[model samples]
Target: MNERELQQLTEHISQQFFGKAFRHQAVFNDRLKTTGGRYLLGTHNIELNRRYLEEHGREELIGIIKHELCHYHLHLEGKGYQHRDRDFKSLLKQVGAPRFCTPLKTVQNKRRAEKRHEYICTGCGRSFIRKRRFDTSRYVCGVCKGKLKWLRTTDSL
Candidate 1:
């Protein structure tokens, strides 16, 4: 859907679920990487990740809209709109909105597949973990002036 459809959907959802009319703009935002949606406190606009609708369908999109609406209504009313606030939590439960958005599958995989390169000092036998491979010949152990040798690489979440 386009920006106009998004705005209309947000307004409809606001009225249906929150008993309020949304007076701010709602648009699909391609730049949103990890978040499903966000309510801008300054502009009172709601930015939704387009990938969410394509991947999770309209149900998930509606949930995200509700979540953002919770923030919008609370902030506009000068009530606590943060996740930790009782007002926010109460509205979320009342509206059936998710407390947190699910992380994008690709993003989660990239984070879980982190690699660590291990090296050991020849003289002191000290072990070090580095994120990237290094030139062992050019670098020495921080202590004992020992030559560093590649040990093993590990991958972990």
Candidate 2:
């Protein structure tokens, strides 16, 4: 569906489930690579992953909408809107919204194959692993405070 359709559907779901009208926007965001949907706290908009609909169909899409709506309504009403809040949990159960968005399998697999940069202390021959590359000039080995050299980077998977 298009943006207009998405907005209409979100509004409909909000009224039907939450007894409130959704005043903010609802749009499909292709940049959402992992989560099925997101509730934007700043703009109070709802962003959905179109790929989720293609993969899981209309029922899943409705569930995602409901999940996002839970965030939307509670946030606007000054209640607990975050996932961990008791108010949020109760609202989710009341509306039958999923507690967590389903993670995309492709994103999960890619995350599992994460690589890390390896570093070794030249003086003590101690090893260190970091998820990101860091400047060797500014940092030293934690164990011996010696000069560090770049070692072979490796993937964890």
Candidate 3:
């Protein structure tokens, strides 16, 4: 959804769940990498990752909104608003909000199974992992200065 829709949704969620009006702005932030949404402590504004909506749909988006709203409402009321705070936990349970922001599944999988190229030293028999392919003829082992040979490929999950 667009920024205007996001603003309206945040406001609606705040009122419906927290019984509090959301006075600050809510917008989509494309730069948000892993987090579903974030609550700005200084401005009391909410920034949501647009990818979350596109990937997970409206239900996940609503859950993220509720989670951020918990932080927004608790912080504004001078209550414990941090993730570890008792008041934050209580508010989250009351609203049925998630304790932690849900990360994008693709990102989580990518992080868990980062692709790596395995190479072995011909002279020393030592192994090395590189993210990018290198010219075996040009590059040598750092430890033994021996020729590197491609061994196998593995996912570093």
lDDT for each candidate structure: 0.93, 0.90, 0.89
Tens digits of lDDT, candidate 3, 1-157: 7888888988899999988899999999899888888999878888889998989899899999999999998898899999999999998999999887666888876676668999999999999988987889999989889999998877766
Off by over 4 Å in 1: 109-115, 133-145, 151-157
lDDT of 1: 0.93
Backbone clashes for every candidate come to 0, 0, 1
* TM-score of candidate 1 to 2 decimals: 0.84
Clashing pairs in 1: none
TM-score of 3: 0.72
Clashing pairs in 2: none
Per-residue CA lDDT of model 2 for 1-157, tens digit only, reads 8889888999999999999998989999999888898988889989999988887788889999999999899999999999899999999999998887667666766776778999999999988989999999999988889999988888887
Ranking by TM-score: 1, 2, 3
> After superposing candidate 2, which stretches have Cα over 4 Å from the reference?
112-152
lDDT of 1 by residue, 1-157 (tens): 9898888999999999999899989998899889999999899999999988988889999999999999999999999999999999999999999998776776666675779999999999999999999999999999999999999999966
Clashing pairs for model 3 are 112-157
TM-score of each: 0.84, 0.75, 0.72
